[model samples]
Target: MSGFLEIRRGRAPLIVAFPHTGTDMPADVEMRFVSGWLARKDADWWIDDLYRFARELDATCIRTRISRSVIDVNRDPWGRSLYPGQATTELCPTTTFDGEPLYTGDGPDNAEIDRRRATYFDPYHAAIGAELGRLRAVHHRVVLYDAHSIRSRIPRLFDGELPQFSVGTNDRAACSGALADRIGELCGRSGHSHVVDGRFRGGWTTRHYGRPDDGIHAVQMELAQRGYMDEPADPSPDNWPTPIHAAPAIAPVLSDILSTCIAFAKGKE
Candidate 1:
């Protein structure tokens, strides 16, 4: 229970991980950024709020308070690109999704990057592993839902507008194909465009922790921000993030997605 980590224990065989919802940046870290807003722009904006209902399902929820700009907990610790030859942020990113530099001058050196990993990244994943171990002890099978969201259009990262729901199971290696199909089916019924194993086929968190044969099923849900937020073509402070209440139309879909995960964990899917 470090200052950077938040965990809610539950008896259910489900763990909902919020890896990028954090916006906090230590003063020293924030000082190096070009702008406060830009540093926080690419965060999984309001994702924690979008999935706030996870608590009601008696699902274990773990999140981080430190911004991903400091160190991306979802990235590979050893510096291997999740998508080789593709543009993606590093474990300790120095730029925004739009290719804007986040630092004033020089970014953290290799030594500093290692320190950030030890200080922040390690504990966050530790908490996740701890929660999973605790739940797997009681349940015959457990599900790890690595929740995330992004702007619908990031030309630097993808071709065009992303699907409303981008579900990933590391190409059926992270979890059972049945679980992924069930979730994709629900997304299709929600009337929202979706793709399985699309551009974001899950990040390091999904790849590292997922071991379906060991009874630990991991899946990553990368939602397009437009599905739940008022995404202006050019977002500024005034209109960048629409309030959570404004996304009522999509709440039922998110709720159904999570419920489906729980049902799958309990072998009811």
Candidate 2:
């Protein structure tokens, strides 16, 4: 266990990847940021807690403690845009989702970016790959559920209000259609707004690891923060996060979605 990564092993053939729930920014790294809170504003806030029940299902949980502001593990390390011609952050983001500059001076140089990749990014993916190998050896198939969450409304990122659930399998190339459909169906049954392969069609983690032919399926679930937390129209330090509480109305639905993922991995669904 390194200072930046954490892995909880489970006996099931499912691994939940939490790449952006971290808030830690190394002291030297923080000194370069414009605002500490803004650097973390776009994080998948409390998603780890939101999916705390993953352990009960015996699903392995792999997470990073280093803030995404330092290095986004979900992005392509080669610097290819995930969404071509669209506005998005890079592997080492220079700005927040809102387009605010994160660094006081020029952002990370090429050397610094390389260092971050070696120190933080590489290990995170290594852990995921290692876990996948371990699980695939024991189970006929394995599922990689990349968990994430964002504000309900980010005009800079998407138009108007976003759906409560944004499911992505890299446009159906990352996982089997059956698995994707079942998860979408469960979300629909929850009566929450949802879209498959919508604005967020997975990320580097999903696209890089998912290989249906290899018996490894990957899917990304991007949840709207409003679905689980109190998101004020205008956020302030006092009420910005609103704490991490299980939204009485949404917890059961999320559980059902995760349960479906485990079932898919076990081929019981």
Candidate 3:
């Protein structure tokens, strides 16, 4: 696709969005990284593969092939800190989840951050915003699921390990009570451990666009990489890799969660 972002159409009221699954960067930008490859580690590798069966559910799937490290699409474009006091990645991060320096002497300055945001972030969100507007116009209500994943444990960011599913509705502010309840219930039935509005209370995209009062609902699912990938405690050049075969162990449950959300959106419509 010529556009940095890719949007696929489905008549369903649900949009399965992958906001952190890219690994591509412009050549000039790639050279800025400490070692090019480290920059790609933050991507939600192979997320589309997890939703390989999304089309079967008639979902409107939207994805990006650019790595989040290049420019986090989930973050606030204004550059305001999402967690305030707590540690979190920046609009242009200087380190990985483990706090490993991604750039050498200096990272992207304010100007570079703005440049990347203009080149990729804004365009990506524009597509997301347009698609959500389209979906809601058609259904009168639309559900946006911001999909993401991270290694199970990252001491620099959080203590211990992350749960398999960390569902965030911005403390229930970004979506309807009905939407959250239905998705949470489905997660329980699917037998996968989950926490609602816990460590991750949603990101900028979820909080900014999920205007249920205006008939738009948004949710974010932060999956522990262990759930679907061969994650490592400390990543290296080769030892750890992603794209683990999707097994029935977690597949049916994920489908149930997504299916329930889809049905919930249609119900609202």
TM-score of each: 0.97, 0.97, 0.95
Runs with alpha carbons beyond 4 Å of true place in candidate 2 = none
Ordered from best to worst TM-score, the candidate numbers read 2, 1, 3
> Which residue segments of model 1 deviate by more than 4 Å?
none
Displacement of residue 76 (Cα, Å) in model 1 is 0.3
Model 1 residue 40 CA deviation (Å) reads: 0.4
Candidate 2 lDDT, 161-249, residue by residue in tens: 99999999999999999999998888899888999999999999999999999999999999999887889997766677778764557
Q: Is candidate 2 or candidate 3 better by lDDT?
A: 2
Best of the candidates, TM-score: 2
What is candidate 1's CA lDDT for residue 102?
A: 91
Task: Please give the lDDT score at residue 100 for candidate 1.
Answer: 88
By summed lDDT, the worst window of 10 consecutive residues in model 1 runs over 241-250
Clashing residue pairs, backbone N/CA/C < 3 A, model 2: none
Model 2 residue 22 CA deviation (Å) reads 0.4
Q: Which pairs clash (backbone N, Cα, C closer than 3 Å) in model 3?
A: 22-65, 22-66, 22-67
Task: Quote the positional error of residue 141 for candidate 1 in Å.
Answer: 0.7
lDDT (10s digit) by residue, model 1, range 231-267: 8898776777666556556778878878888888888
